[model samples]
Target: MDTAPKRILLIDMDDILRRTLAEQLSAQDGLRPFPVASGEEALAHLAMHGADAALLDATLAAQGLIPALRAGGLSGPLLLLLPVGMGVPIGGDDHLTKPIRLGTLLTRLKALLNQTDTQSASAGMDDILSLGPYRFLPAAKRLETLDGTRIRLTEKETQILNHLCRRGGTAPREDILDGVWGYGAGINTHTLETHIYRLRRKLAAGQPLVMRIEGGYRLATAPVPA
Candidate 1:
């Protein structure tokens, strides 16, 4: 399994505090922190490289940063650092009083991440992800046709399909490999190709539904809910 560190985006205008928090988070076992001086910087970073969660200074929320991040496609849990005596704000998943207690921050952040993980697992079990004419039940490793015919998928086949579907129906092969098979699984392009071949054979949808693109692969149509 890929045991890479979870990325946390730390947004704060206080250079001293941001740097200190970033340093502290970096020292933790499974966290990698990216500290930004402003909301604009945070958005730019998020557009290019996504974060698993965010830690935002509450003052920035007053400036409309929360909606902007959401509009920019950041779907991570956001933890707000509020000034003492302030009530919970509008857009944060959770909050911590300023003059932050490091222990408390870690605890709350981890809890939020865990909650997100649990929710995602639940969604995978229940949500029928759609791509073209099929409904994909990832947790069950099965696909359903419009007529309710079920096609059993291997675990790896399900992972590959889900990965492609999540990436808007097109993803670089390297990213798909890392996402589905883990970075250090000793799996290679040949392994991926073999899986892709099997998956295509099983999909059985006419019109070349899955195709090899330049430097990547693409689905003929985008993913959608059935």
Candidate 2:
């Protein structure tokens, strides 16, 4: 069995509810919750750090977080927490009303993660891709060197590298943004550049792994000896 913990994004305006859910979820062996208090914070976090699943409060519907999440290219399972007497909305993959049972929540999350893993395997995305001397595992969001040194990758860094790898190790700027951030060609955001800069810093000791071409980025494709 894969022992990797699934990262869950927990969003709620109620401080007590957010803290409680975060604590309970973290106590689970295979779950880790990244809690945020408001829709804005949630959106920002999701934009930079993708989650395996999300738990959102229905109260944030007024803030339009659901639509924003889609626009931000978060393709993970979403669970909406509704207030008492509230009807379920059409957006989330699953939902639970207020006064939620922790056991039920855990079951739902585990099911969702299992479904995602099966889908990923069927799609042939479970294999690791080689990047020079490093091994890049997209589904696991992990990078490791030939010497067995593991390197931590932020969500954005992993997404960027994965996109580049899929595109034959090179992708134009607009195409990369579209693939990774779901942003259109004309939309301007420095977020991609910032992530690339930081990622380069993290990979500094590795061979010139990521490089900027005329219009975008590419990974070093030269074969590495096993």
Q: In angstroms, give how far residue 42 of model 1 lies from its true place.
A: 0.5
List lDDT for all candidates, in order. Answer: 0.75, 0.75
Model 2 lDDT at residue 39: 76
lDDT string, candidate 1, 1-226, tens digits: 4478988999999988999999999999999999998998999999999988899999998789988887786666788898788754455655678899899789778766664554446435466777777777876668888889887664456666777777889988878766654433343436567666766776667334568998778887787776
- Where does candidate 1 have its weakest 10-residue lDDT segment? 180-189
Candidate 1 TM-score, true structure as reference: 0.55
How far in Å is the alpha carbon of 113 misplaced in model 1?
A: 0.9
Tens-digit per-residue lDDT, 1-226, candidate 2: 7777888989998999899999999898988899999877877888898777899998786457787876776667777899998865545655678888998788666765665565455432566777778888767667889889987664456667777776778899999776655556886666567777777777888776788889888887732222
What does the lDDT come to for candidate 2?
0.75
* Count of backbone clashes, every candidate in sequence: 0, 0
